[model samples]
Every structure is written in C-alpha cells, then in structure tokens.
Target: MGRTILLKMLLFFGIVFAFCTCGKRPVADLPTFHVDVKQRDSASCFFSGYSYVMLETNMECLLTDVDKIKVDSEKIAVLDRERILFYEHDTGRFIGKIDRLGKGHNEYLSIDDFIVRDSLVYVLSAMQHAILVYDVYGHPIKEIQLDAFYKHFDFWDEHRVFLSSDFGNDTYYNFVLFDLRTGTVLRRFDEFSQNESVFFNSFSSFSGRNNKELYVIHPFDYTIYTLTDTVFVPYCRFDFNTEETFDMGKSFAELSDQTRNKSVVKYLGNLIESDSVMYLTFDLFDSHGIGTYLYKRCGQQSYLIRINEDFISDFPYLSSPKGIHGNTLISVLSASTILDIEETYGLSFFRKKGLNKEDNHVIFFHKLE
Candidate 1:
C-alpha cells in the first residue's frame, strides 16, 4: 500500500510540472471572445469633460500635423512632422522640441512614430530608416538603424521594438520583431496579406497598457492578438456581420480616385481595449462620416457615441479617441477644426488661450466615470 501511494504522488507532481513549463499557448488553443457592439446614431456621454489646455506654439515649437500623441509621467509628447513637441505635465506650457529635420547623424529626416519609455523618447524615422533616442530635456542618447523601411513602430520592451512594414522586398510577415540592443531581427510573425489597401490604412497599428502586455490589429485581417511570452495568442475577434466588411481585402492603391473616396466610408480602423472598456472606429460606407463605438465589459453593453451631440457641441471636432490615459479618454482636435468650432459656436476658449486657429491645437481630455 505504501509503494502504490508513492507512485501516485510522483505522477501528480509530474503532471503539475509539465503544465507549468508549457509557457504561452498557441493562438488556436486560446479562446476568443466576441464583443457585441450595438449600432446607433447617438448615445449618452461615457466620460465627463474635464479641463483642457492648448499646446503653446513658438519658433521652436511650431505645431504642424500631429502624427501621434503620448502622455508620459512628466510631459505630453506630440509627434509633429519631424520633431517631438514637449509640453509640461500639469500645465500645457510648451517646453521645447526634441531633435530636428536634418541629414545629420542624430537628426531625423521624417518622423514616422514615437514613444516614451524609461524617461527617454524613441523616434522612428522612415526616411532615415532608424530610431533615435533622446532624453526628456532634448538631449541625444542613442540611435538604432533598422534593416528595412518601416512606417510605424512601438517599443515592445527596453530591448525589443515591434515594427510594421507595408513595403519590402519580402512578403512574408506583416510585423517585424526587432532587437534594439544588437540591431538584428529577433522574430517575425503575422503573415502578410497581398493587398495594397492594408498599407495605406496602417495607423495606430500597435498599442498596449504596459510593457508586458501589447496588442496589434491588422485592418485587413480584422483580428486582435495579444503578444504573450512565447506566442501571439488570439484575444478578440470582431464580427461586422456582413460580407462587405473591410473592402474584402481589396488594395486601395488599385482603385481609382472616385472608388477610393467611396471605399473610405466603411473601412475598419484600429481596436483598443483597456481593463474594462474597448474602443473602435469605422468610416461610413455610404456617407462621409466616422462612427466611434464603445463596448462596456462589465455589463457587456455597447454604445455608438453621437459625434454631434456628445462630442462636437461641447468640445471641438475630434479625429477619434486614441487611447485611455490614466483615468481619462484622450482625443486630438486640430487647430483648423478648433478655429472652425470657435467661429461656428462663438466659443472663447481659443481666444482666451491666444492661439491661432490655424497654427496650434488643443487636446480634449475627459475623465472616465
């Protein structure tokens, strides 16, 4: 009886050890949940509007087109044309711009995307085909030259950078996992879809809540993946419930100017999720408008925020709610749109800031309730 009990204990221990050492499961093995989004023309306000500060502009900080926006511990970093426009954390006072547009070793010609990590700014320059790092106070730190041209990228960790390339000689993977320390290709996954439209629509392609957890969504693929320790596990699959979802992987480059304009109506954009809420947007297939959707996880409820009623009337016109920062849902309103809003609504917020409606922009931050 003692020998039989000993054998059973060893078998149980072995089974437990095997499961613990398995690491990340395959995408096929992980379960995928479907978020039910109710289609609507308008809904109630999800977040309450708090105070907002316009970005101050000067010779060194002349704001042009904002490519991306990130909120750090001490400042707000805005990726303008070829430089990073920094603003004070608590107040929207302009600090300075990092780097510049030049052919020099440290300067970048074209800034594609940027992120703040460990109090350092990593800027990706597609023209230069390199990423330059700068300290918070506008000092050069390091630079890494990529193997190929990439349009957008975000830091996977301190050592690895996840890059998205639309054009390359090889057509195997959609994203390249790059090592920053050695400047070599670590790994690549996400098979490329032979469609040109996927390249043009690639913006806000990668996002995450933290270093350990990051997610990427391909517009042509329409599936979300969570990068685990070992594998890219399938997280959420969206069901548009129609055959016409996403132009059927059609390349927008092949379409005529009229067809391209018509196709923008219903193109799917990015999918961003927080601890409880998920946000996604799509253009109208029939009309010239953009619709934003929100899915509440606790109640499994969905809402299509009315742009005119909930957002535009109170705040200026927004491109889209990009991501959640701290306890707020953040969005960008361009200077041109803010000027139009001021003229149409007779608002004095722009006047009080002494900002030219065509030069500088304002960020709308609403506290999540």
Candidate 2:
C-alpha cells in the first residue's frame, strides 16, 4: 500500500512539471519580408475640383479646393464649387448635380470629409459638428451630432462609425465610436501621452477577417494601437526619432527638426485592409520639403514606404489619399486631376481628366506592375 501511494504522488508531480514547462515556452516571433522594387510611373487619371468660400458673421470659411474625390465603382460623385457633380466612371460623362443648396445652407453645410458605403453616403460637416447621412440618390436620411469637435470619420461596420477629433492645444485628441442606427456613444479611447505630450492626428482603424481584432494608427508619432475585447490596447509603438529605424540619414532628421515647427501632420488618408495586411498614409514636413510615408502593418512589426520627391514634384496637388477596391490608392492630382493606383502587392500610377479645364488633370498610383 505504501509503495502504491508513493507512485501516485510521483505521477502527480510529473504532470505539474510538464504543464509548467510547456506554459512557460515563448511564442514564436512573427515573420517579415522586404521587397526592393524600382519606382516606375504608369498612366494618368483626372478628377474635378470645386472651390468655395463661406462668410458667417465676421468669420470667413474659405475652401481653396475640393480634392481627394473617390468613386464608388465607376461613378464619380463629388462637390465642385457650390455644385455637387456626378460623372460616369468609364466614359467620364457628366451625370448630374446631386446637391444644390443655397449660399446660406452651403455655408453652413459645407462638406469637410465624406465616405461611401454600399448605397449610403456619410459626409462630415465640421462647422456643424454633425454628420449627414444620405442615400445614393442624394436624399438626406438622418444626421448624427457629436459632442466634441470632429475632423473626419469612417465606418467600422454596418452599425458602427468612428469619429476623430482635432487635437487642440493638447497633444492628443480623443476618438469616439458611435452607433449609426441608434446614434449612441458606444466607446471612446484617449491618446497615450509621451512626456506630457499627447500625439494628435487623424486615427485609422480596420478590423481583422472575423472582426476579432481592430487596428488603429496614430499618424503623428507613428504608433499603432489594437482594439481587443472591445478595449483599446497598445500593440506596438515605434519611435521614428532615430536613424536605425527611420533610415533617412542626416538629411531626414535635419528636415524633421526644421519642419517640426511650421509643418502640421494631418491624417487625411484612409486605412486599407486585406486578409493579412493593413496600410495607412501620413504626411511629414521639414524645412527642406514635405514628405509622405506609407506605413504597413503585417503581424507585429511595421514597415515604412517613403513617397519619392520626384512623384510629388510631378503632382503637387496630391494630398490626402485613400484606398479603393481594398487594394488601390486614389487621390486628387493638382486641382483637377484624379489619380488611381494599386497599393497592395505592388505600386502603379493612373490618371484621368476632371470635368472642366481647371479640373481636367488627374493622376493616380497602382500596383498593377
């Protein structure tokens, strides 16, 4: 009986030891790949430009240009001056004007940003601090008013919307999520402060395949946040202030320091997501010139893609760019040019002409090559 009892005790100890050893094993590191491709220019595309100026009380809201217009499939619907124009994506034929608000209404309802999902159009009106929902036929459905000042917004899913507020004197601005059907505040996240400095810029969010995980980007500091279990969590943080990481050499750092003052970093782009990858864009300016970086998030680490100066020099009006068809990058070229290009797998450029002569030139980049 004593021998049998001792054997049982030894077996229990063995099982516990095995469990602890397996549990303590570290997880395998994520894999990474680097691609070296020579830059090449492709085709040209065009888009229309609108100009407007609003006077309210003693303040003036001037819209120097309406750029970065996107198409739902092949149809172009964007505001030009005081008129909202629609065109056939293939033939570039003028379809009709969508919105014809009076000067008073236009001044108050000027579109700050817009997003298209299915048959619904979501436009952000910064002056009103509200979002106007409209159908494809240009009919208003409903509106959502946010308590804080918002700069841009994006749809998380069919029922949820994410809004980004402008960073005031504070280093970071708050991001809020709202329910579209009920217009209820669902969740909010604050920026992580660095040395009492909160990094503020437009934020980017994309969900995984099963929507099990959500990814967010802080454009100012090159930080990436992931939302898990309905809570915002820091997945990885990158410091672009060093050489080993930034790789711009001395010129890049000097330029970053100089432009750090007059240059304002804005998140005027869209987040592109695939089954396994995500991409985002952010603009950085230094005294030398302005530069835009395309940041890619694979599994854990992030990769940087720098926009060449030659491309920017050729197309000066290209600012904030977004994704179309989940793999292409679309942006406005000059005041009148529209650019469409593939951003995933590889990079390519395409351009089209806008409606009028002032809006006739468009340029875009793709990854067809």
Best by lDDT: 1
Best by TM-score: 1
Residue 249, model 1: lDDT of 39
Residue-level lDDT of model 2, residues 1-369, one tens digit each, is 999999999999999988655423222322223321122222221212322111111112112344435576656655545334555555555554446343444233566567767766777776677777776566677777766556666667778877765333132445678787787778876663422222332233331222454555543333445553255555443333321222232332343454454445533234456666665555555554656556566676455545544444333344445334336555444322222322221323332212332344342434311
TM-score of each: 0.75, 0.56
Candidate 1 lDDT over residue span 1-369, tens digit each: 999999999999999988764554555655444533334533334555555667775666766666667786678887766678888867778876785678876788877788888888888887777988888667899889888777778777668878877533254565778988899988876676453533443245564444466676654455667764345655655555432233453554543243443423233454445566665554343343444444333345555543443446544544466545665656777676777777877776766766675566677676544
The per-residue C-alpha lDDT of model 2 at residue 240 equals 39
lDDT of 2: 0.48
| Alpha carbon RMSD to native, model 1 | 5.9
Angstrom error of the Cα, residue 102, model 1: value is 3.3
Q: Rate the local accuracy (lDDT) of all candidates.
A: 0.63, 0.48
